[model samples]
Target: MGVGRILLNILVVLAAIAGGFYQLKLKPILVKFGQGRVIDPRGNTDCTTVPELKACEKLVLHQPSGVVYLACSTQESRPHWLPNAQRFNATGASRTDYVASYNPQSGKVTKLKTVNFNSPRGLSLHGMDVVASSSNPSELWVYLVNHREPLSGDPKVVGADSSVEVFKTTLGGSTMEYVRTVEDPLLLTPNDLTGTPDGKAFWVTNDYGVKTGLIRDLDLLGRATTSVVYCHETEGCKYAIQNMHGNNGIAQAPNGTFYVVNAIGGQLTVLEKQADNTLIITDVIESDRSMDNASIDSEGDVWVAGFPKALVLVYEHFANPTKVVSPSTAFRFSINTGPNSFYGQKFKVDRVCDRSSYTLSVACHRIT
Candidate 1:
């Protein structure tokens, strides 16, 4: 072995070590970090008028007072590196996700307390009581499929199973307090929920089963194997309707009729309560856009949040988190009950809000 041969051997050894480190360690870490990264698109558009409206996931209105409460998840804010890493930050902390209250008369929004749970997606309120579904992954064991601990802290402190949070608002609509959290095995992907008039029992929509990756995507594109569960204080949660296609929002009318939106099917199903407390499908109304949550106004009309463009807004949000703008519309429909049949009348569809944001729930001010 001469000097040149020895040098060549040394070079080969060093190159082999570098290749192993890159292939085995560095690549996996990069892929894991990339999963949590968000790429926001850059652009600007001024459509604040009628054609374009602000995006909101859930909206609840105080009937007599006309105070509108909105749950704006700001899902785009979730994927950024620093915020994703820290569940709680001491310095320059990120804005907490909150339920915002909009005064229809004054046009002023008062943001309530930041929700304790992550990913506050859907919201429903009756009188001063409110219920919402939190779909945070660490909050739910289901999200562990692609779980990556926020880069900086002990993963244990930041992650837990998901649940539904209940709250009560003051009559003045100035404040709210956390009442209790509902964790049930039946609540596998709880999306939107509606409370009873008395605020005792509630109904929730599970968007999908315990699934992820391509299977979940395919299930959504096809008919979703989701269901709606009725949750009670003593009896716990039970299945109300099964095998729904993208079950989303749910609302109950004053007459005890239930209205549910099948997001993928683009239709609203009207359910009537039987003597045994089970619900019977009374009617189904076709919709032009993907329907989300439904709220019954004082006049027995149902107000729904409509996603006109399907999942284009969702793709845009993932591609360009910041610059993505999606259109949102609200529709008002009337339900006429006959002795033998049920009829639905489309009163009007209003382009209330727009932008890159999505609206989840809708409610009208009713003095109940």
Candidate 2:
């Protein structure tokens, strides 16, 4: 064959291969990842961005007092040391992160002051839960995920020495008393948690089995190495559910059922607690967009914060949150009691809040 003809044939073969790969592999995956998805702004247009609550990740709403608790940090610090985001520059991480309460009715915001919390590395806050005391009406238990930088190791190499910290505070009060820090080897890469009312035990999500390096990033490609750990003061910690695909935020219903949302795969795994305190998967609900954290309401509905555009969130927003704003949405998953319930619809998923413009930034990292 002539040299020109041979080169042309080679180009044709490469083009055919690329076209097949795009159609078979990349297209389906990107569609599942929420690429080119536009959220409708009809009944879901009631969301307003609170300027005071920037980078507040997880939120727990107190049904009695109508106060919302938030685990917050600055946007600048999040791109530096969020372990889930895989940005591990600990030197730039915020050490003075805080928990704040916002009253929707009164339009008041209070930063709960820490008392007797003397950790040298301070609080690199992430996921959190606010549980009311079983015995006292005025008392509340705050479980916070503190991604504390290791004291004597490179954070990029060793990852955060993550643990769940328990704090005691009064309802609507501005101070939180440091109770104790719960640390276990199983507490690796702790993300979000749901705590017991007695403040003695909790179940936390390990978003990754391995702490640092390439293995941790395997979750991006649909790996199932994350898990949930049941931690108690005396019993230590153990895995409640292992080999979870994308464990992120977890919330417990009043009836003891747990709802866990995934970050990359966007699966909501519903779990039921067993007799031995471990959890078993009861059902799995799928979402069109990737989700970060989840919260249970007073009426037993699960509210999840979802990322509408995965590419913008992963590439643009996290890289420069202040400059670029990614689209966001709020999903409510509840028991299907409508007419569709008879048609084998066990649950109803609704997009309660949708913000597609730059005004509302609701990426996977922060919600509320």
In lDDT terms, which candidate is top?
Answer: 2
Assess candidate 1 and give its lDDT.
0.54
Q: Score residue 263 of candidate 1 by CA lDDT.
A: 69
Per-model C-alpha lDDT, please? 0.54, 0.84
Badly placed stretches (over 4 Å) of model 1 are 1-55, 78-95, 114-160, 318-321, 336-368
Error of model 1, residue 111, in angstroms: 2.5
lDDT of 1 by residue, 104-169 (tens): 566676766633434332232111224332332111110001112233543334331335566655
Please, what are the lDDT tens digits per residue for candidate 2 over residues 301-324? 788887778788888888898998
Worst 10 residues of 1 by lDDT: 137-146
Model 2 residue 67 CA deviation (Å) reads 0.7
